[model samples]
Target: MQGAQRNSLRLLQWMMAASLALPIALFAIASTISYNSTLDIADREIERTLDVAHEHALKVFETIDRSLAELNEVVRDLSDDTIRSREPALHKRLKQLADALPQLKSAWIFDANGKSLVNSLASPPPNQSFADRDYFYSHVDQSIGTFIGTVLTPRPPYQGARFFGVSRRRSSDDGSFIGVIQASVLPEYFESFYARIGSDPGSFFAMGRTDGVLLAQLPRLDRDFRLDPNGQVGRSIAAHPVHGLMTIAWPTDGLERRIGYRRVAGYPIYVSAGLETSAIRGRWLTTISQHLVFGLPATALLFILLAFAFRRTQHLQLEAAKRREAEEALKHSQRLEALGQLTGGVAHDFNNLLTVIRASVDLLNRPQLSEERRQRYITAIGEAVARAAKLTSQLLAFARRQTLKPEVFDVGERMRSLRDMLATLLGPAIEIVTQLPAEPCLVSADAGQFETAMINMATNARDAMQGKGRIVFTVHAATSVPDTLAHLSGSQTLKNPGFICVTVSDSGVGIPAGQLGRIFEPFFTTKQVGQGTGLGLSQVFGFARQSGGEVTVVSEVGQGSTFSLYLPRAPADLLPRSPAPTTAPAVAGSGMSVLVVEDNIELGNFAADGLTELGYSITLVDNATDALTELVSHADRFDVVFSDVVMPGMTGLDLAQAMCDRCISVPIVLTTGYSQALSQDGIAGFELVQKPYSIEELSGVLHRAARVKRVRDGAAE
Candidate 1:
C-alpha cells in the first residue's frame, strides 16, 4: 500500500508539471516556423513593390525608343534637298522635338567629320569636333541605320554639357556613313520615377546596358558600374532573362539587397530596382516579435498558474460546489423575468377589457336610455367579453400549455376581420394592404392561435418598418412549397397535396443576414429596451408549430421583408362549417337550481349572487370537494352543475368526470379566468363559460345547461 501511494504521488507531480511544460516547448518549435512564414510574406510584399517600379520604367523606355525613331526621320532629311537655306527650319524642328521629348537634352546633326552641322538651340556650328568620339568611331567600323554608342564625354573645348544619347547613322544610298543624327537625353529623369517607390535611403534604381555598363543611377554614380555574372544583378538576369527578383550582397557597395531587374525587351539597356534586404526583414520581424512578446508572457504565466493550481485544487473544488448551490437561484431569476413579461401583456389587455365592461355598465345604469342605445351597449359588452376570452386562450396557447382547437377556416376572411384593429394600431403613416383571394384556401388550425399568429406577424412588420410603411397581407393556395419559401420556413415537400399560404410583407429596413436565423428565438428582440419583450415572433412560431404549420422569412438590407406561413389545407370532406354566431336576447332563468363550485370565496359569492339575481336558486361551495359532498346528499336539487375549471382541490373538470362515473344526471358547466384544464382536457359533455363574461353571457350558458339537463331527463322517461 505504501509503494502504491508513492506511485500516485509521482503521477500527480507529473500531471502538474506536464500541463504548462509541454506548451512552453511547443511554443519554441512554433517560433522557428512562424519566423519563416513572416519572411515569406515579406518577400511577396517586396515583389509587389518591384512590379510597380518595373511598369513605370517600361513605359519610359518605350517612349524613348518611339521619340528617337521620330527624331531620326527629321534628322535624315536635314542633309537632303532642303540644304543650308533650310538650316533655320531644320534647327527649329530639332528644338521642337527636344522640347516635346522632355527626357532629351538636345537634338542635333553631326557630319562624318564629327563637326556639329545643326543644333537645336540655333547656335552657330561649332569648330570643335567629335571625330574621336566612340560613337563617331563606331560608325566607321559598323554598317548601320541606327547605332547605340557608349557614354559620351565632352573633350577639348566641349565641356560641362554631358549627354547620354542614342544615334541614327545618316548613310548614303550606297550605304556609306554620312554623319550621325543624335538625340541626347539627360540622366535626371530616372530620379523622379525612383522617388515614388519609398523613402528608404538605401533603395535605388540603375539604368545599365546588358553588356553591364551603368549609364545612369538615381543617387548619381561617381563612376560607371559593370556587373560580372558572379555578382547579384547579373546573376538575377541570367536566371530570369526578361524580369527577375533576387536578394544578394552587392560586390561594389557591400550592401545586401532584394533587387528587381528588367531587360529593355529589344534594347541593350537593363533597369534594376533594389531595396536593402535587412530593412524590410527588420520591419517584418518587429511586427512578428510584438505579437510573440504579448502572447509568450501570458503563456508562461499560464504554465506557472497550472503548476501552482496543484496546491489550490481543493479550494477550487469548494468554490465550484458553492457555484452549484447558486444555479437554482439563477434559474429562479430567469423564470421571474419571463413571468414579468407575461404579466405586463396580460395586464395591458385586461385593462382594455375592464374599460369596455365598465363603460357598458355605466351606460346601462342611465335612467332614460333609448331602447336602441341600450341594446347596442349590451351588444358591445358581449363582444368585448368574447374578445377577452379569446385573447386569454391565445396567451395560454402561446405559452405551450394549451391543446389547440383546430377548425377549418379561411385565411382571407380572418385577415379582413383584423384590418380595423390593425389599422388603429399601425396608425395613419402605415398603409395596410390586403390582397386576399375571393375564395380563400381552407386550412384546419385553432382559430384563436391563427388569429394570434397573424396579429404577431403584423406587429413585427410594423416594428420592422418603424411604424411607417406599406404592410401587404396576401392569402393564396399552393400545390407544393417552393424551394425558396422552404429555406426560410421548412422542407419543400408538403405532407398534404396543397397548403394555404398566408404571407405578410412590409417595405421596411429588413433584418440582417446574421440575425434572421435567430429571430424566432424567445426574448431576442432587436428593439430598444421597454419597446419590446421579444416574445412576438416566439409566440407566432409556437402558434404555427402547434397548429401543424410553419413560418418563414426572406429579407434584404433595403428592399424590406416578407414572412410566409404555410398551413396544411383541410380535406374536401371536412366537417360542416359552424355558422357565425348572432347576438341572442339575454333571457332570465326560470328559478333553475345551480350548484356553483369555486375555490376563491370572492368568486364563489359573485357566481352565487349573479345566479340568484338571474331568477335561479344557487347552492354555493368554496371548492369541488364540498360541491361533491352536497351533490351526493341532494343529487336531484340542482338543474345545472357550474364550476370554475381551476381549483385548490378536485378541479371542475375532475368533478364533472367523477359525476359521470357516479351516473349523475345534472348537466355540468365549466368556466375560468384562464386555465390550461379547458385547453388540455377540453369541455367534453359540459358547457364552457369563459371568465370576464357579462351577466347576460353567464345567464345564456346556465340556461343552456339547464335545457340540456331537462332534455336528457325527458329522453330517459
Candidate 2:
C-alpha cells in the first residue's frame, strides 16, 4: 500500500512539471510572433510616412521651378525695351512686373555697363557690379537666359537670404546686347511649400541641395535636435544597408532612441523616423519578468485544478474582454458623430447673424452724416465689421456654406499678381518659379477664392520647405480626365476636354503616405497646436467643389507632392471681365407710397422705417394675408406692393396672384432670404430680390417697380 501511494505522488509531480513547461513554451512562441508583427507594422508605418514627406518635397521643387520660369519670361519680355530712351517706361514696367510677380524678392534690370535701371527691393545693389556674377557672365556667354545659382543674403538694402537669378542679355530694338535683366526670388515664398511637405507630427522632413547642403527642414528642430546629416546620420544614409533601417542612438526624453532613415528619390533629401526601443518594449519585458516570478507557485498548484476547465475559462474571459473593447469603440464613434453635427449646426446659425450685421453697418453710412464724423464712424464700424466677417468666414468655411460666385479669369494674370507678395512672404531662402501660358486660358471660377486658395496652398508649401527650398506654380490645361475623377460630375465623358489645371508643387521634404488622405479634413492637421488651424485644405476643397471643379493631389515618399486644381472652362464671351460694382443706390422712396408686408414684426418695422427715411410713404403689416387685404381695400393708395416671399398665412407669390385676381394693377416685388418653392417659372411676372438687402438695393428694386406700375396705369387709361 505504501509503495502504491509513493508511485501516485511521483506521477502527480511529473504531471505538474509538464503542465508548467507547456505554458512556458506557448508564451515563448506568442512573444516571438507578437514582437515580429509589431516590428513589421512599425517598419511599414515609417516607410509610408517617409513616402508622403518625399512627395511633398517634390511639390515644393515643382512650385519653385514654375515661379522661376515665370520670372524668366518676364525678364525676356522686358529685354525688348531700349536701354537709355525707355528708362522711365522700363522703370514703370519693372515696378509693374515686381508687383505682378510677388514671389520675386527683388527684380532689377542691368545695363551692359552694369548700371541698374530698375530695382524693386529697398534699393538696387549699389553700383551694379553684377557683371562679375555667374548669372550675368553666363547670359553674356550663351546670349540666352540662364537660371543661375541662388543667392543667400544678397547685399542690402536687400536683406533677403534666398534668390534665384534668371538673367537674359537685354538688347536694344536693333537686337544688340545692352545689359542683363535679372530677377531674384526670396526664401519666404517657399515657406508655404515646406509647411505642407513636413507637416507630420512625430516626423521631420527636410530637403538638401545637390551638394548636400541643407536647404530646408520642416518643423525646424531645435538647434540640438537638428541633426547635421553630414555626420553620423548622413553616413548611415549613404551606406544604404539592407531593409533600409538604421537604428541610431540619440538622446530623447532622457533616454536614447534607435533612429531609422531613408533617402528620398529624385532629390537630395533624407528622411529619418525613430522611436526608442526601450520605450516600446519596456512594458512587455517587465510583464514577462513578473510572470516568471509568479510561475513557480502557479505551476505547483496546477495539478490540483481541472486543466480542461481552467483553459476553457481563460478563453471565455478573452472573448468577454474583446466584446467590451468593441462596445467602447462603438460608443466613441457615436460621440464623435454627435459632436460633428452640433458644430455644423452652430456654424450655420452664426452665418445668418453675420450677414445681418454686415448689411446694418452698410446702412449706417448714410450721406446725411458729416464727412469727418462719418469717416471716423466708418473706420470704427468697418474695422469691427471686418473682424466679424473674418470670424463668419471661418465658420462658413467650416460648414462649407460660404457663397462662391464663379466667374472667368485668367490664371496667368492672377499668378503674376501673387509673385511679388510671395517673394516678400517667403523671405530670402527659397526660390519661386512660375510657368504660365503666354495667351490667356480662362477658367470659370471665383478669382478671389482661387487666389486665396493659392495663398493657402502656398503657405502650406512654404511650411514644407522650412523657409529654404523652391516652390513652383505651373498653369497647364489637363489633356485627359484622370480615372479617379471619372465618377465626378462633368468629368465622365471628358475626352480631351481642355480644363485649366493650376499645379502648386514643391521640392521640400515630402508628406507621408498614411497622412495624405486626411489632410483636407477640417481640424485634421499634422501641425502642432497654435501652429495651424488645419482649415486651409478644407477651404480649398470647398472652394473647388463650389466652383464646379475638383482638386487632386499626387505624392510619393521623399519625392515631394503636387496639388492640382482643375477648373472648368468658361464661355468665350465671358472671358473678358468688367470691374465689380463697389457702390449701389440706396432704397429711397421718391415720395412713392409703398406697401410692406412681412411676418416678422421687427423686420417689418425696420423695412418701413428705412423706406420712410428714403422719402417714401410706408404702410407695414404682418403676413401676406393682411398685405393682400390692404392692397385690395386701398387700390390707388399704394403705388407698389413689396411683400416678403415667405409668410405665415400666405406666400408673397400667393398674395401677388390674389391681387391680380382682384384686377389690381399695382406692381409686386417679392423678397426673402430663402425661397425653395418659388421657382423662376413661378415668379416670372414678379420682380424677385434676395432678403437682408441694404436700403440702397431695396430702393433700387422699388424704383424699378414704380416705373413698371406707371407704365401699366398709362396703358389702362
The whole-model C-alpha lDDT of candidate 2 against the native structure comes to: 0.64
- TM-score between candidate 1 and the true structure: 0.44
Model 1: pairs clashing at backbone N, Cα or C within 3 Å:
none
Each model's C-alpha lDDT? 0.72, 0.64
Candidate 2 weakest lDDT stretch, 10 residues: 393-402
> Candidate 2: where is the Cα deviation over 4 Å?
1-371, 379-497, 504-509, 512-552, 556-560, 576-582, 660-663, 678-685, 715-717
**For model 2, how does the per-residue alpha-carbon lDDT over 258-315 read when each residue is reduced to its tens digit?**
4555555544445454445664466456556676677746765674463544455446
Worst 10 residues of 1 by lDDT: 488-497
Residues 229-298, model 1: lDDT tens digits: 6666666688788887787786567778777777766667777776676776676567667867876787
Each prediction's TM-score versus the true structure: 0.44, 0.36
